[model samples]
Target: HQRLLCEIFNEICIPDLRSNINVDRILTLRRQVDALKIHRETFEKDLNELEDKHIDKKRKFLELNEKFHNEYAD
Candidate 1:
């Protein structure tokens, strides 16, 4: 009777077991997606800050170059 019950359970419960496994996989993927989004936002913010700094430096350099040329042009 035990073997018969085990066979019955295997036949009846396999689908449920497979569904639970799929649910776990979906949850894990969702968490990974959220983490990736956060990483992307941080990367974008850092890139913007670097770009702003570069622009500021370029403006300063150009201004200084113009001043030097004006003061010493022969």
Candidate 2:
């Protein structure tokens, strides 16, 4: 009876502990994936805003340059 008790305890308790560790690892990985998705969204929004500002600036510079050339050429 004593030998059988020790055998069962070692087999059951050790595997249970290992399964708990695996669960904790899964939770940690999920949190990191959520964080990366949020960061990517923020970065895309910022990139779009910057692109609009660049187009506006370029348009204004061309208008001013054309006006200056016409006035001086006359």
Candidate 3:
């Protein structure tokens, strides 16, 4: 009976414990990492857009200053 129980446990329980429990934990971590990557990408895109807008505004300001200086001869 002891040998039979050992055989049964080796066949069923160990495989279930190793495969199901570990796989669940690994998959959960993978999902969280993927979500974090997406969140980081969104922030990077927003920062790039803000930088582009700032450059555009600065260019316009400089161009207006040049125009006024040329027109008034100052």
Candidate 4:
């Protein structure tokens, strides 16, 4: 009788164990999103540094060009 009751409960209620499966999938997606966010922030920081260096180089080049013209024009 006990075995029969266990079988009946499983037949009626056990197939919806999918909720746990979906929870695992949701957690995995959340972890992926966090990893992508970290990558984006790192890329942004590196890009900003490169842009700053480019601006500094441009400024130095202009200053040298102006000084050369002033000394040679006379």
The lDDT of each candidate is 0.90, 0.90, 0.90, 0.91
Model 1, runs deviating above 4 Å? 1-21
Assess candidate 1 and give its TM-score to the true structure. Answer: 0.70
Q: What TM-score, over all chains together, does every model reach?
A: 0.70, 0.66, 0.63, 0.69
**Which residue segments of model 3 deviate by more than 4 Å?**
1-21
For model 3 the local lDDT of residue 6 reads 85
Q: Write the per-residue lDDT of candidate 4 for residues 44-66, one digit (tens) a residue.
A: 99999999999999999999999
Candidate 1: residue 74 lDDT (0-100): 58
Q: C-alpha displacement of 23 in model 2, angstroms?
A: 1.6
Candidate order by decreasing TM-score? 1, 4, 2, 3
Top TM-score: which candidate number?
Answer: 1
TM-score of decoy 3: 0.63
Instruction: Give the poorly placed runs of model 4, Cα more than 4 Å off.
Output: 1-21
What clash pairs does model 2 have? none
Q: For each of the candidates, give the backbone clash count.
A: 0, 0, 0, 0
- Tell me which residue pairs clash in candidate 4: none
* Candidate 4 overall lDDT versus native: 0.91
